[model samples]
Target: MEAFFKALLGEKAFLLDNNSKMIAPTMEGKKLHNLERLLLHVHVIVEEAEGRYIMNQAMVHQLNVLRKEMYRGCFIVDNLKRQGTESNNYKGHDVSNSFILSKFNPVKRLFLSDVDIHRETDLQQVIDNLSNIMEDVNGIVVFLNNYPPLYRQPYSMHLFIEKCMFRCQMEMGRIMAFLMQKEDQGCVGVLPIVGPTFVGKSTLVANVCNDARVRNYFFQTILITAHDINSENISTLKDGAVILHQNNALDQNNERLLAIIELSGDIDVVAWNSLLSSSSYLGRVSKMIITSRSDKITKFGTTQALVLTFLPLEAYWYFFKISVFGSIDSNDHPELQSIAMEIARGLNGSFVGANVTFSFLKDNLVAQYWRRYLSSFREATQRNVSLFRESPYGLVCDCKPITQLIRGDDEFAVWGRYHACPVEENVPMITMKDVIFGRGNYEGEFDVLAWKSHIPPYNSYIVKCVIEKSK
Candidate 1:
């Protein structure tokens, strides 16, 4: 059997040689090392770009493209390492029935092949991509010093990532540029940001509005929700809107207002027209931002609408991997890394789900615990897919109820009616973590904290949940 394997593998047989494993690194291991170095280099460039106080639109666009390449490289390298580890284990074990292997999609299964001819090609492409991005950004790095630096407290990469927007830099840059534009003497510029539910539209807008540059530009920043705009008193929008920021340094007569309107559905035409006319009370040079899930809002924008979508799968895995490992090195826990990739795939790009799952997994680093979580997660996802013909992510997006198996036959039914409350306001002590991981016994209907935003508009997401007995 050994002779036959050696004949088939030829020069690659060194990868299967257990004796050489202690003395030499495998081909995948070497690629991972090279990729890590490239990732670090790209990260430094991206971080420097992020620190500059101002960047031209062209530079911002370039940096955004570079960021995506960095994320793609990370995903490829991580998956390569994961496949390598699994391949070694499969040499002596029969893992054909493994849940992890069974759950892989067609594309993913291709990565698990014994003789993966595309692995080398994929790794090389990632390396080349990163190297090209690094070369392209060298000029941008040189010009970065021209812009003033924003004063920020020193923070680790993970902490910075945790506290700031995940992958909305481009959108933020566009909005900032729009806000700073010199408007026509008597015109009010309208910029509409459109996205689906729970896609970070509110969070993105909140962060951009809270920026120092934006705050210094606009004399007053107001937040207007659908509730604030009544069809009966459409003209009263100026009075009913919530004041987010006010700059007393600016002259009252020359003050410019930044109005952010949040909508759940399509706005009535007459009410919108009346609202636009009523904005004359604020100032002519003032600008308005409309954020809505409906695409109809695009017509209201003076410029092209800034569309937001969930992060790409590769980008999301990088985000999830960092959130899960935090300051710890993922290389130390190869088994956990494989489990994490599976869990991330099961999440279907849900940011809140990533935060919630990572918070729990970070505390329990054991392989057994992680495997259990993955098993339970897969089961819950399959159950939802079978019953509703939708995944958990789809249900969450639609604001529909999702089931989480608690213990044995019991389940936690998370209701669709959920809302975010200010941090200062009263919030539920019970969290989704407690219920999902079976931390405590609870009964009847109660509110559960789904996620708490650490960034601007620091609000806690509360979901109505009920305990159902027997499935």
Candidate 2:
């Protein structure tokens, strides 16, 4: 049969093997095609799951697993595509190791230890894993339709991405399930959310509280900050707390209350007990959510604690790409996309850093400006890591100064003890953008708006900036 086909087709017959199966020119091409298909399948499944108003505990867990695999697949495909571009631009160059190592931060190294960029078998294994996950998701898709649909207002894709929670869908679903569940009489549910500083613990609680389903299910919602908890006695906490949502129709004793407490550190045993004791006065069947940076607070929860960590490198890159190139096709500008990937790697999964960097990069679409920004950012990051053994972002979280050479030989010190104020309050006119890009002329220390949150409980972050004189 092979001889006959070869004779009939001549040279073109080389496209088929002895078995008459069409041959792929390269394994990379085949993997890309498979990854593209798998990505589409996982995306559809995730979208369907997200649209459902309710999901059982098992369904939520399954969806979470599927979503994570989808992120991993995206990371692999993105790296492959970027490499393709580089290979096309410069033939016969071995840049795989450096390119792959650039994406491996502390968090990514922990999760992606098995993935070897140089090994074809490892890449094939990731694709195979994704394929297996798709088979499992088939069962989830069938049951997704049984759940009711949620009504959401129409918004542009970029706006929706900016406003909604990024990758916390499963956590949100779990919390929603906990809130809507029926409990025995006089049994108040306590949920503790723990994470590192600025890991979106407060934002998560805020988004959950703002959900229409959560708001309607509970009669009243109250907010207690660390200040409110410390300044006022536990008994008077009710009076001092800010009522976020209240339904007057429910009687005082019968009201279902949700109290969201934000703490900077761990709460003492006595203080926690007193707070729980005081919750009775609010209503019956109350739910308390405590958010803190300390894992020690996890002991206060009635159920398992929800711990949040930095987003995986692949997932963070996905978000960073969307935010930086809003309504712009990245494929059209391969060079800029490459530069953006380098910048994203330097960010170390810091959402605030991504936002601030994108805010500046979006203003200037030229390659020169982006290259300059990436250069300076890399220098600052290297300096921070060398001096403090931490990334600039890590230093910022610890409220320590980070050094930056914004332009020329001029150096500047950015104090990390930034203050966040409600949107209604007035903030400094000079913003981080102005300071970072050398837009403003300031003599001494002054506060500048770092970044603003677009979602509920909107806040403006203000950081202090000081100009360092050259020695």
TM-score for each model: 0.86, 0.84
Give candidate 1's error at residue 368 in angstroms. Answer: 2.4
Q: Evaluate model 1: give its lDDT.
A: 0.76
Superposed Cα deviation of residue 118, candidate 1 (Å): 5.1
Single out the weakest 10-residue window by summed lDDT for candidate 2.
14-23
* RMSD (Å) of each candidate, 1 decimal: 7.9, 7.6
Show the colliding residue pairs in model 2.
none
Tens-place lDDT per residue, model 2, 80-175, is 656556445323433233433555543223223333356467567768888887777656766776887653553333554687788888889878
* Candidate 1 lDDT over residue span 97-140, tens digit each: 35446635432342243224577787878888778777765577
> For model 2, what is the error of residue 6's alpha carbon versus the real structure, in angstroms, after optimal superposition?
35
Q: How many backbone clashes does candidate 1 have?
A: 0
